[model samples]
Target: MACLVIHGGAGTIPRASLTPEGHQAARDGLRDALRAGWAVLGQGGLALDAVQAAVVALENHPSFNAGHGAVLNAAGEHELDAAIMDGRDRRAGAVASARYIRNPVLAARRVMEASDCVLVSATGADEFAREQGLDMVEQSYFTTPLRQQHWQRAHEEKAGLLKRERTEAEKHGTVGAVALDDLGNLAAATSTGGYTYKRVGRVGDAPVIGAGTYAANDVVAVSCTGLGELFIRRGTAQDIAARILYRGDDLSSAAAAAIADLTADGAGAGLIAVDAAGAMAMPHNTEGMYRGSVTADGVLSVGIYSDDFAAVETIG
Candidate 1:
């Protein structure tokens, strides 16, 4: 049995702020990711490869916050972060504060395939990506008028120069995927551009192993988004898997509990998970999370808000 689940960050996404076309676009992005992973699984690929492909698709989409459409940092630069894990043996790879590399998730997978290191950061990460012959794009490639406007607005707001506050959707965005392959192995991946106008060289949970990304064949695979610091402080991903492995909790229970822990600490966050048995869970403390799942039984669902969950069903 094989299943795939994905998330495109979480935050306050009021229905009023989303046009029907915009909402459908995000849903289509999720469906594209699901189909991308499903194609790999259909061909008997490893869970790691399936998830990598799925996340790479998200990274390439200009509608999301990773890769080509990443938001600018406080310095008006793009510094990306990404992580991936294989449950079969708990192998993990990550990159942070990276620039020039077009797809950070692909670079992360290369780190797992070639390097002894689990995490690499800053210019060093960029250098490593080059040495590995990964695709590189001009820094301008990541810049969009929307991101530039966001950075300027953030700077102004922080200085009390703007009367209107930014919407919650502008505050955070990330892309992640989790998968179970026919071989009974699981994997998870996450990628992000960090918060709008974040400090350059700032690392986040997206690249922190066991925090935003974790997988175990015996328990669960997890990928998280939202506030990076809180997710790291609570080791969000691993804690969920730990609950399932040690505390004898089921998939949904452990996932909801983990998000609740983050909420209890006054943090906003969300995560997507899949257990060894192919049961999937996606939970968030925010009003909305861009998420989707395709279970082993062919139950395919996607939603931008909790209210949309009950309305979606299997593609079959």
Candidate 2:
């Protein structure tokens, strides 16, 4: 069986805050990502390729908080994070706080195959990207009118210039994909621009293998988003797999428990996961999660808000 699931982010997406146009935009973005991953799986490609291809679609989409449309940091710059994992060998690659790379996930894959290390950061990651001939663009390339507005609003909020409070959607966003291939291999990939107005060098769960991304042939492939601090502390992604592998929990129980664990700790997070048995779970302790999924049946479903999501979107 070949299946893939993906998420744009998880948070309180209030219907009031999302206009019909915005809702449609989010659904369209998810559909685009689904088609991209499905194309790979339809070609009998590996899960690794499917996951990467899916993530790239989100990264390129302006609606998602990744790659080209990433949010800004305190310094008004974009520092992207990404990670990818392969189940067959349990190999992982990641990049943190890199500025120049167009696609941090691609750079991460390069590190996984071309280097001896599993992680890279800062100046070194930039050097690696350049050496690998990864696309380089001026930092402004990541700035969009929408993100610039966010950065300005955050600055105003920090300075007590804006009287309004922040919305849940403004608090978090991330893009990730997980896949199980026809060959029974699993893989996961996650990419993010971190939260709005974060510290310049702040690195979140996206680039942390077990926290935001994990894959294993005997357990599951997982990608998580939200509350990076809590995810890192709890090893969120891996914990879901652990419950399945060690505690005999099914995909549903394990995924729900992982999100429950985070919420009990007074934090919010969400994840999309697929087990070795081809069962999939997308769990979140939030108001809404922008997500989608596809299975061997060739049907695709994408949803934005909780009340509007179809069960078919979660299952197939």
Question: Would you list the clashing residue pairs of candidate 2?
Answer: none
Clashes of each: 0, 0
Lowest-lDDT window of 10 residues in candidate 2?
Answer: 307-316
Report RMSD (Å) for each prediction in the order shown: 1.7, 2.0
Report the C-alpha lDDT of model 1 over 109-222, residue by residue, as the tens digit.
988889999998888888899999999998899887767877888999889999888865677689999999888999999999998989777888999999999999978999
lDDT of 2 by residue, 1-316 (tens): 8999999988645778777787787888888898899888988899999999999999988778889888899998999999999999999999999998998999999989999989999889999999999998788887888788878888889999898877656765899999999999999999999988998899999999899999999799999989798999999899888899888999999999998889999876789999988898988877888899997787787777676666444323
Score every model by TM-score.
0.95, 0.96
